[model samples]
Target: MFDTPQSTRSGATAPPPASHPTLPADRPGPHSKRLGYIAVIATFGGLLFGYDTGVINGALEPMRDDLGLTATMEGFVVSVLIFGAAIGALIGGRMADSQGRRRNILMLATIFMVGTLGCVLAPTWETLGVFRFILGLAVGGASATVPVYLAEMAPVERRGSIVTRNEVMIVSGQFAAFVINAIIFNIWGEHDSVWRYMLLVALAPAIGLFVGMLRMPESPRWLSSQGRDDEALEVLRQVRSPERAEAELAEVHALALEEKESQTGGWSDLATPWIRRLIIVGIGIGVFSQLSGINVIMYYGTQLLENAGFSSNGAILANTANGLFSVLGVTVGILMMNKFNRRAMIITGYTLTTTFHLLVGIFALAMPDNSLKPYVIMGLVIGFVFSMQALIGPLTWLLLSEIFPLKIRSFAMGVSVFTLWIANSIVAFGFPPTVSALGISSTFFVFAALGVLAIIFMWRMAPETRGRTLEQFEDDFRIQHS
Candidate 1:
């Protein structure tokens, strides 16, 4: 068993805590305001992530017409970004680990800008798909890195809320896309190429993230891992209260020093029992989060509305409600993250979302040809959005950020989110065809069944990370291995 600063299962000497110099009573150190600034900047990556992915929902119709896309081709276009995101999550995690979190996000900003421009300017379907994949790289990178950055930087007590703020932004971005799509489509709905304007909206935020992150401090936990404790402490001083900063740094320093003896930040480390178990849980969180079928609503809300018998314009406009409530749900999620148990919230969300899915499916099946089906389906869709964003959506990203040990946090997160993207890709690619074959009722029923399985997994496997330090979680896992 490895020794840690805290008492081990095998009764070893607990290392003494680090000494910190006291400051004057009048001198206040860092506060939540600075942290909030950092969060705002970092979550821009999330915002861009949301807008880029969500833009496709409304743009797909115009894109299909302009590009003469078959149903298969449209699905391919939508799913390709997810497939690229899978690759991005994998690569971005490793990059964040080796290159530092701040540096990686800056890089992602550049990629977002270039990829967005490429997509906006693409002259052919092949080119658009390729650029979307490029944008996927930025999206995946942001997904893996931003939450880790926020989680590592945030105080333990407030970590859930702070990290999950990115979810709020992500949904907010999607909301913005829906609103923009509605306005743009209303004005230019007759034009086959109006989608280009929608795609261009993301470019400004990419630039903002790139510039804003330049002034932000590096993640103290990451610096600690790199043997830059002094730098880490300084960064902590910028974001946390003086006492809290010292305490957090103390924990980070201890872990960093202990792990210094033997580096542990790669795929090979997964061979050990505890690390393997942790990653499996991580993978489960990632997979089940997507399996909740939230993205079906996200990526195909307009199409789903149209399928339910709304006209094209009616469907696009109705999606605005989806976007609005998603923002509301995530806002509620941000408020509740600090108050609720992570596992309980996720389970509750999955259960409710699954029920909603079943209801939507059953309703659609019962009234498959009724004139009222569209309105009823719209209400159910709104219910699904509320259920998902408030719980499963925010909590998924929160848990993924909090679950892994710092040593392998980024790498493990990459794999977990990679799994998420894969599940997402499968759902995205399959949904078009599935809906085509089985109709709305059966499609949602399939999602509802998956949601049932997600609840069981959350109940049995997911950890409670509500009130613990990164080092505390690491020590607990190490003790389990011992």
Candidate 2:
């Protein structure tokens, strides 16, 4: 929905103001370097979020065996966290908006720690699901809040790269979890406590995030919006070049004034035509992103492969391949984000994914059920996952970060991403039944049909937001559908 004036200037090309005497004349010094480290440390919340959500891919079978779980209990164990995450996403936004980003994250870190503990020490399926749900609350909130915090703290030029770096970290965290899970599962395949080890590994990163985020500053934009200019400036100086800091502060102050005057925070903002349209676009992105069935692959790929005919070991190994491809695809997507138009990338991604879905369905139907079927189906499934990670995955998070106004960034993102988790839960819970009834080919064909619809929706409604500042993007969003 953006209508901002396009500029080809690189991030480094923006000129400093003449009057801001405190601004750096050349480049940042050692202090700025340290600030970058702090940002990474603070964003480790994302890493923990990624690991906790993805670890189940390897651990599920062991968990099922240990708990004597049926299909419904297994689904509950996996998808329960998603249900909690949906709630967290809804409430975490308000917390971030009112309590401040730093505080909310710290609280999330505590939740993360507690959730991990609950999972590790769980005596039964019932206990494990409860803890996982708590874990999901923290993960969901962190997902909604971390990107906004990163975006606000980053320099305008580096904003996309910095915020997207968290996405990279997220995928990397998932990769790390998969690798760790493989190693642990391989070494302790016969051990009764194997799943416990897999689940407990998440605690290290949670501890790291909790401790690291405590020393980080609150978001400067959030502070400025609250009329705490001095604190905001102090935060800005810590993260930005001295010369650039003042100008950025002025810009933030101007925007905060506008926000305050308009009283455009919270659900009421959605009443305005432009705001309503923006929220719709945000929710659309969330729904389409999930409807791509990425979570179906992430949360249930191993089961899907087993159904295709692989032994348990083979399925676990093949699932690892899926994780690796996901990491690789996200790497490619991040590299291309700066080079490609957002809308074009999304359209191309949906098209490719839909085509793969159809091909996989056809292959599943035509090939007689045999040992070769698992490997063949594995190849197609991994291919679809790669397409999603390379295209839709990064784009979905990127667009969510790009669209909303500064005033409602956290709240709006929470609402949209909360819906994302709900969608994920629906797929997770329904996938087994869907597969049993419709068969794999038919199930994927349904996804393929949805993919085509997503493509059409993107072409008509999604906006190109690449290479624009947050302030400029906001202006563009206000009038995009007018």
Candidate 3:
């Protein structure tokens, strides 16, 4: 068989394609700055996504008290939104294809507003759950659309870093949630509805995203696919230097033409062995990311810490550290994206995370159930978050965005992310019961086991996309399986 495309080659790979033009380090270019502006605007969706999901971490206990939630009901409260998110991801992909990335984000922002409003106004547990599910539609849509939007808008050479910015924003949003939750809780001190204030804080970012995205350009790749070549070129020129814009537009347009010529049907095209293989890889990556059980810390950190023996106030305060370290980790991960191999970094993350998982379990099993135990376990949890955010979290989204053929990219992302949310929903819903039955030590052991399987999956199926053009990856997929 022909040598695998140099871009995806394991070692001694060729450099990035020429279409990914670079400016001198001494001086920043207008084009890069413009691209940065667009990225910042689009990633507000990620901020909203993060805040909406994470606000519940600290808010849940108060909500439980307000709504009189039982353990099963609490699980339902958390997991139901994730289930809604799965549907949102499914629909968001198709919407991105039909509605345009810009429009879909605008719509998601509106959904965010509506969801937040509903939650804030929710007077009963049933209504609160309904609104959380509504909020999840926006969260899931943003999750499905934002990365794909960034990937499509980005320069081929800068794709990894640019797309991963959304990941950073996601973590940043979570950090913001934790900080706000702490502030509100500390100030209000067991007020019956403190969670409402926390939920309401999300409205600011939702409004910002809606307003900011109005001025953002449509994805050039999406435009090309729609036969709007002139519009596509204009969007490219706004984000790229004149020469590079022309060149990249040519590449995108040619791929668009090829897609049109193929006459392949959507969804059914996935049945082909090669496309099926890609979906499997995509789904595997998506599922594995969640199975890492990082959300245990993200969603129910307070409960976990309380279980480990911290008081309620102590748990929320300590959870802020988790949020802080998460931002630091994702920031480091973003900086490292251009500097390391994707597969190696992700595998290392998995290895480290799995080790931490086992260590946490081992400590839980061995430690006395005393004051010292929570601190030690918290340290382990912090390390796990650091490792996860730095590697698998960002890399998983980046891979999912780039892995599929462009023709079905959004749809495939939806499907992949839908599977991811499904996994997330299962974990979120099951965690309380699992922890109740399995105990914290046993719970982490299960996660560690999943991490081991994740390593195997990455080794066997994950492709290296760094330094490769999306077009090149597309070509590689076709050449290898055709």
Candidate 4:
């Protein structure tokens, strides 16, 4: 086991590989300035990812009305996209490896555009589902590709901040979706077909990503891996000082040579007990991440609030608060990252979120039929979202990145995130009928119970990975598990 570069939006646990050469620090030269511009352009993929997923929060109601969807159909409509995402994520990771990161991203952008156009013009729910599945392919692809592109392109010292840009853009994009939904719903509240306009919002960034990436250079590390040292050095020099670019190429070249000896592992690696255990841990982390019920709010928050007591317009507007608090949570989470132990943050996060979930269920069931009941429940749900995004949400990705050894790191991360999406699909698909049969109060009670289970899982199974260097952590992990 060896260290690999992996981190969450917080950029925690982002130490460069010990086996690689030291990278140059970020400089204030023209090349560096241009590099910042390039990063901004590239992370448009993340922005599109957030909007496409979130626009459905408010759009689902209108979409169902226009398409005349049944409750079960509603569940499948939402779940199918996630199922596609699961497969897309795995395929996208491999594409990133075999194809250049830049090429994969460019292709994903086109898919995003096509998916957006299809959804906007979809005449039937079945047609909508097919296009949504196509969009999921793009979403999952961007998820797997964009961060790697950023990490590889960024200066070693600035990788944390640069890679983190995509995450910030993601949350901000969700907020944008909510805001746009509210505005559109308010101005055109009478229209039954307003949802088409909501989904159309994603097309802009998808176009931006495609256009902007045409000017971007290929990843230097990837170039080196493919035996194109001259091309790699040229790309690096455009983004770094000439001397730094030359030095980094030698290191990248050396690392590329080392990789040939330990080529990425396959199914046989899973036969090894230690690797298998960590793989289970990786998948478990993904499972717990979704079982926390965060996406229930993300995908269904507008409808959830409508059930709680808000009017159609009020619900659409109020859901913006969830999006807003998410941005806030990610902000605070980033600040807390440097200070808190990741495992401790996760445990405490689960506890707080569980408490909030319990409160939401309790208030919904026990509160008198009054306006106050909705407000009280709304506050509690916000608490859940904030605590989730602040700790468990980002930490889920971080832990996935941290747990796997270098040899199979990409494979494991892809598998785990795929599980996360499947878990998400299961929850998303079941949520509507569960609410129909059990009501929102009981449904939340179910989530609360699941939250308790997630807490237990983290306590017993999660690794304490804070403060230690990645090599030491992986070594200790291997020995302890063995």
lDDT of 2 by residue, 1-482 (tens): 22123322221221222222322332557646756786687668878877988899888888988889897898789888899989998889889999899999999999999999999999999999999999999999998988888878866555555677777777778778888999998799898779999989989888998888878899898999899999999988887777677887897788889889787478888778887888888888988888988888777777898888899788878888888898888888877766666777888899989988998899888999877888888888888888888888888887888788888888899999999888888887778899999999999999999999998888877876675667766875675555
What lDDT is reached at residue 91 by model 4? 82
Cα lDDT of model 3 by residue, 128-228, tens digit: 88988998898999999999999999876788899999999999999999998888988995699989999999999889899999899999999999999
Could you say which candidate leads in TM-score? 3
**lDDT digits (tens) for residues 362-478 of candidate 4:** 888888889787888889999999999887776775566456654565566677778888898888877878999999889988988988998888777777654433334566677
Kindly indicate the candidate among 2 and 4 with the higher lDDT. 2
Where is the poorest 10-residue window by lDDT in model 3? 18-27
lDDT of each: 0.86, 0.82, 0.87, 0.78
| True-structure RMSD for candidate 1 | 5.3
**How many angstroms is residue 224 displaced in model 2 relative to the true structure, after the best TM-score fit?**
0.7
- Using all chains and alpha carbons, the TM-scores for the candidates as numbered come to 0.92, 0.91, 0.94, 0.85
Total backbone collisions, model 1: 0
> lDDT of model 2 at residue 313?
81
- Please state the error at residue 286 of candidate 3 in Å: 0.5
Clashes of each: 0, 3, 0, 0
> In model 4, what is the error at residue 328, expressed in angstroms?
1.5
